[model samples]
Target: MHEISVAAALMRRVLAEKEARKLERISQIVLQIGPMSGIMPDALQFAYDSLREGTQLEGTELVIHSAELTTCCRHCLHLFDSRLMHTRCPRCGSEELQIMGGDEFFIQYLVTEKV
Candidate 1:
């Protein structure tokens, strides 16, 4: 699954920082996930839980900060919130639109220990 790769990539970064800080263990990992990120937090958490065992972050918690999905209308020059991929604009009921935010899946921050 792609979640495996995603976890691996994030772990690599966490591990490097842990090493630099002389951390004996990791505490938690915080992620900022937008609504339209298309990545399942539950699936990612499960994957991370399985893959993290026996590693420096074996007991570390994976916390996700959920983000909302929003879009902007190009025709009416209006902004609105959306949970769907592409729907008519809420302001002017126009189909023409553009994405302003969301669609993000990134690591925001991490908490670790310094041994």
Candidate 2:
């Protein structure tokens, strides 16, 4: 699945960083996936399992920091949170909006052995 590939890519980067820092193993991985990132955590977890096999982070915990769609109203200059792709501003009910956040998926932090 797509999540599998994403997990694989993530693990690759983490492994590279771990080696550079002389870390022996990973205890946990914290990830942030925005609302619009379109990546499911369940699928990602499954993928992580496969990708982590035989790696230093084989049994590491995966923690996700969820993000929601945050938009700023163009007309009222109000900031609001949403779970929609496109919707009227909640504060002023305006259609004119500028997306301020969401659309992100990346590793935030890693906890690992010092060496």
Candidate 3:
């Protein structure tokens, strides 16, 4: 699954940073996932749990937070949350909109124990 690959990449990144900083171990990983990022949180957690065996992040907790989808109204320049199937602007009722958020997938922070 793609989530396994994503988890592998994330682990690689965290391990590299841990080695560079001489960290002892990772305690937690905080992730920010956009609703439209196409990355499933449960799949990601499963993949990470499967891949972290015997690694520095073996028992690390994975915390995921979802970001809301946002859109900018082209006609009124108003930025607002855009729900699925409701793309119209709430302020101006315009259908013309440019997506501003909800396409992000990234590691926000890592809590680590000192070496």
Candidate 4:
């Protein structure tokens, strides 16, 4: 699955960070995922857990934060949560919308121990 590749990339970044900073251990990785990011948290977690074995990242915690899908209605200038794409605005009944959030996937922060 693509999650495996994603996890691998994440691990590579973490390892690089550890090496660069001379960290003794990494305690946690905080990831922010949007509803439309097309990445499953469970699969990513499983892939990360599997790939971290026998590595410096072993026993590291993966914390996932899910972002809500939000949009702004052009007609009414009202901002609201949009659970689905192409959703009509509740206040103005307009299909014209500007996506404000929920299409992001990134590492928010990492907790590490210094040697």
Q: Provide the RMSD of all predictions against the true structure, rounded to 1 decimal.
A: 2.0, 2.1, 2.2, 1.9
lDDT of 3 by residue, 37-110 (tens): 98988999999998999886888888899888878889999987754646688899999988877888998998
For candidate 1, the 10 contiguous residues with the lowest summed lDDT are: 79-88
Best by lDDT: 4
| Candidate with the larger lDDT of 1 and 4 | 4
Tens-place lDDT digits, model 2, residues 1-115: 5887789888889888987988777899999988778898778988897778887788788888888888899999998787776678777889998987787798999888655
Candidate 1 local lDDT, residue 77: 86
Instruction: Estimate TM-scores for all models.
Output: 0.83, 0.82, 0.80, 0.86
Q: Candidate 1 lDDT, tens digit per residue, 76-115?
A: 8887776677678877989988877687888888876666
Taking the candidates one at a time, how many backbone clashes does each contain? Answer: 0, 0, 0, 0
Of candidates 2 and 1, the better by TM-score: 1
Any runs in candidate 4 off by more than 4 Å, and if so which?
none
Q: Choose 1 or 3, whichever is better by lDDT.
A: 3
Instruction: Name the better of 2 and 3 by TM-score.
Output: 2
Error of 1 at 39 (Å): 2.7
Q: Which ten residues in a row have the lowest lDDT in candidate 3?
A: 80-89
lDDT for 43 (candidate 2): 87
- Name the lDDT of candidate 3: 0.87
Off by over 4 Å in 1: 36-38, 113-115
- In terms of lDDT, the poorest run of 10 residues in model 2 is 82-91
